[model samples]
Target: MGNTSVVLRNVSKQFHRKTSGPLTALSDVNLEIAPGEIYALVGPSGCGKSTILNLVAGFDHPTGGSVTVDGQPVSRPGPDRGVVFQEHGLFPWLTAMDNVRFGLDVRKIPDSAEKAQYFLRAVGLAGFEKHYPRELSGGMRQRVALARVLANGPSVILMDEPFGALDAQTRLSMQELLLDVWTEFRPTILFITHDVDEAIFVADRIGVMTTRPGRIMTELRSALPRPRTYHDLASAEFGRLKEQILMSIREVIAAKTE
Candidate 1:
């Protein structure tokens, strides 16, 4: 594609350690996501999956190279990029609609309340608008969190294990719901997850990373067709991709252990 939505060129990030020299988190990592494409990153713990996410979200700066979205360098978090962390990060006292409305209100978006309601409905939380975060189930709270992001109408949606906390069944439903939202809004998504199946389920391409000083070991393009269902998870092609990713991850970990 001539125009890329999210781009990271030779990106590297390091953090100063208390007792040692700088700790490298990522090294010379490069990734490009086309507009409306869903890209996923999967790797072992401490492999800098979240580090890559934070870089693009503009929550942190890289030590070298560049991070850009929509052809512009990212210096700080902006409304153009929406992020959903593993935790729902909702206000405990706020109702679902209010939680979704919070961002719109912060941006001073016109008709904030109405936009919040519409997004809540879009995420299948129509009747739960009045439910407080404490009153809602884990899945519902996550739905509200997702609605809040969608309401912002971001060009790039950055997610770090957004559904990793849910139970198996709830997580499946949420995965399906995510696909529906992606189809409707078509925001370029950068998803970071520990689950290989989840990555295959939601991503157009998946990058597997090494254990430390995280670098992409390989990238796999999803061959499974979209509007994907759990039934598709049983297909030979899905199993093949999952097997390939798992094998790659295992090899990396095994090499480190050896």
Candidate 2:
């Protein structure tokens, strides 16, 4: 995937509930993620963080304003945008290698066998190509999901709490693997997570969203050194950033309650 820039201009999303009529999930949200950058969105539950990712991924459209990738308007899902959800979403019947190859095959991409094998190896699933989703561990299934996306040659990778379902240790390992793969592939990423520490650990910049009718409450650049490790989680700098983000979120929650 080539480096691509993502821009959201005054974006708003409204959903109609059967009982509530129209509900605004996001209101006048604006953001920009530069080429090859990792941007994570974190906020209170139902803050529309995933809504932002869905809009950027072209899975849904904003009722107002625009979303563009590399200056082109986003109207629908395309090969240029690949998404990974909290659920692995792999085929039950397909082998790990075949699941990845399915994406390339859909795109009519040549050399899918080689590409599938390459990404499986990249995600540390080199020997599990023949394993089915049911046979693999949670982490391995997520790796397959990731490999499927990477194999598609997308310019942007949209992840919606992809590690949220994992155990603490596996989550940490997946976070580390994600950073390593991001460094190697350099695809622009838009990640949505509830964990503030996870956001701080993996992102180049973190955006805190306001309580629903969500908007960017604040944006913080992460200064923690790269090739980050578990040890870095205990560092003063990491703690400082964590505190800053938590304080911002606490303010949002406090205001809501008041």
Candidate 3:
């Protein structure tokens, strides 16, 4: 991993509407993501968290400023940045194995089947390779989605509420799975979520964003010891940090409603 994985300088995004007028989604958003670190953006719904991810993934262009990955401006989607969206976005017709192999196939990688299987196993889906997305459980399907992105060997992972659809138990399990995968791969991750605990548990740095026309309100470094486990959440220190974040977020929410 390199020193700095991504940088956004004064980035802003505006969506032109036909009747409602221009929608300012992001405003002067500046952020830095260090290599091998997990940085999360947490905010209320419609606060433009996904818009930030879209800009980084080049799914959409910023109306102002710049977004750079590995020192290069992001102009379009590339294999260097892999995205896992809330919707798995898997091909319904393709089997788990084929889904993971899709990126490799697109890149014309030799022996893509072998590489795909390796990633399937890495994400704990080895035995379900032949199963199509519809045949798999929601959690299993998401595992395939995550593996597919990882198989491409992206330097940065952009996740937009990837676990939001799962049930509580499944969500917790997926979080642990993500931690395991992240510990091993150490890819720079920018995860966007509405869940406060999820952000605190998963991120090395938590960025709180204000409501629409969103700008970063505050950034907090997680000083908690790493190799974190569920037990850590019960600790007094964890509770204190969680309280602080909750307070900050609540303030943002309150201000937006007023």
Q: Quick one: best lDDT, which candidate?
A: 2
Weakest ten-residue segment in model 2 by summed lDDT = 1-10
Instruction: Pick the winner on TM-score between candidates 1 and 3.
Output: 1
Best by TM-score: 1
Which residue pairs in candidate 2 collide?
none
Cα deviation at 106, candidate 3, in Å, is 1.9
My TM-score estimates for the predictions, one after another, are 0.98, 0.97, 0.97
TM-score, predicted candidate 2 vs. hidden true structure: 0.97
- The sequence of per-residue lDDT tens digits that candidate 3 reaches over residues 140-257 is 9999999999999999999999999999999999999999999999999999998888988898999999888899999998877778898888888678778888888899989977
lDDT of 2 by residue, 1-258 (tens): 123499989999999899969999999998989998999999999999999988888889999999999889998999999999999999999999999999788868899999999999999999999999999999999999999999998989999999999999999999999999998999999999999889999999999999999999999998888888878889998899999999999999999999
Off by over 4 Å in 1: none
Instruction: Report residue 149 deviation for candidate 1 (angstroms).
Output: 0.5
Candidate 3 local distance difference test against the native: 0.92
In angstroms, how far off is 206's CA in candidate 1?
A: 0.5
